[model samples]
Every structure is written in C-alpha cells, then in structure tokens.
Target: MEYDIVMEPPTPREFVHLRSAAGMRERSLDAARAGIGDECAAVTIRADGDLVGMGRIVGDGATVFQIVDIAVAPDHQGRGLGSRIMNELVSWLEANVPPSAFINLIASEPAFYEEFDFETCAPELVGMDLTLPTESESSHAQ
Candidate 1:
C-alpha cells in the first residue's frame, strides 16, 4: 500500500494516539499540545487517510536539532514508512539547518539510525535522561 507522507506535524490527538500505538512512551494531551507544531521539521504518514507514522526535529532552531517521535504503526512495521519519514526530516534539515548545527537523536535501535549516519556516543560521552513525575506519580510517592 502506498502511504502519503505529509510535511507537517500531526494533530495533538493524533500525536498522542500514534505514539502509544507505536509503543513509544505515553504522552499526555497537554504535553502533546505544547509540543506539536513546534518542530523545525516534521513528517507524518497516512495510509488510507489514517495517520500511521510520524517523525520530527526539535531544538533551538539555530545551533542544535534533535530528531524525535519517529514512529510507525505496529501493523505498518517492516515497511519503509519510518525511513520515508526520516528522509523528509533529514532532507529539510540538510536544506535549512546550518552545517555547523548539531543534529542528534536517542535511538532504541542504533543500527536503524546508523543508516542515516547517527553514531553512538558511548565510552566518550554518556546519554542521560530524567522524567518528571506526573501528578498521580507524585501523589503516589508521598
């Protein structure tokens, strides 16, 4: 099946839904609302008019950019939808972002992203992250 790749972020509702459907971490609607449409570049794929894949680049528009939210629906895995999404985002960055700008992403599958020239930052630099507790999490901790 041919998928339509659109050069735009998905709606907040669609973003939340597809993120979950793709087994990515769950994001609240409020977070989605605050995040969607803020990307330097974004790509969304639709199959038969239903959103099935998405990717985005975010950061300070000048010197830093991070690719995030790369997803493909479970049923759509094994297809090239994820690659197509990355192709669009990378192309946009290549055309627009400065050569000196830094582009990065946190990848679960390093092999996959290595195809796009992403290298591991281990042994030399460690990647760390922290997730702020949600209201329920905070209440439960007390």
Candidate 2:
C-alpha cells in the first residue's frame, strides 16, 4: 500500500502510544510528557491523518543528544519508513548540532542503524545498562 509520510512534531499522547507499540522499555508516558516539551523534537509520519511512523531526538541541546523512539506501526513496517525517520533525524543533527556534540542511540536493530553510520562500540568501549534500576537484594524492579 502507498503511504504519504508526513513529518511533524508528535503530541505527547501519540509519543506514548507509539513508544509502547515499539516495545521501548526506557520511555514512559509520564517521562515522554515531561521530556518532550521544548528541548526535544520529534518527527512523525501520518498516513491519511493516522500516525504510522515516528522518530525523536532528546537531549540537553548542546553537548549531548540521543535519538530515541523510532517506531513504525507493525502494518507499516518494511516500507522505508525507518529510513525516512533516520534521514530526518540525521538531517536535523547535521543542521543544528555542533561537531563536538555527542550523538548516540541504543538501536533495537543494529544492522539498520549501521546504514546511517551508527556502529557498535568496540569491545573495549562497550557499555550496557538495564532500563530498570535494581535496589533490592532478591527482586528486580521496573
């Protein structure tokens, strides 16, 4: 099916639902609502006025920036939406962010990210963390 990908800033409600549908555990409705107000910017693709894909950039706006919440609804996958989102993101970064700024993302699909010049950290520089913090001895918390 043909889709008209519209790129625009997403509403808080749309951000929450799309993040959830994308299986992103790091973001929550409250967090997105709180963080996406001014500094962060997002681009969403709508087909016939219905949201189908989205991508977002969140950061302190100077030294650090991370791409987050790139998602396309299941029925809309494999149709170049992902690439469109990444292209928009990269363009934004190139236009606004400084050369010394740190741009990063935790990609769900490593292969896809590589297409946009994102590479896995070398073994000596790799870092990983759990989205949920552990504060107890026996049980994990989210």
The candidate that achieves the highest lDDT relative to the unseen native structure: 1
The weakest ten consecutive residues by lDDT in model 1 span 120-129
- Per-candidate Cα lDDT values, in order, are 0.91, 0.79
**Model 2 regions more than 4 Å off:** 1-7, 133-142
Model 2, 8-115: lDDT tens digits are 667778877876777665466676777665645678898887788988888999999988788988878888999998998898899899899988888678999999
The reply for model 1, stretches above 4 Å from the true place, is none
Every candidate's CA RMSD: 1.0, 3.4
Q: How do the residues 24-117 of candidate 1 rate in per-residue lDDT, one tens digit apiece?
A: 9999999999989988888999999999999999999999999999999999999888888888888899899999998888889999899887
TM-score for each of the candidates: 0.96, 0.81
| Best candidate (score: TM-score) | 1
Error of 2 at 9 (Å): 2.8
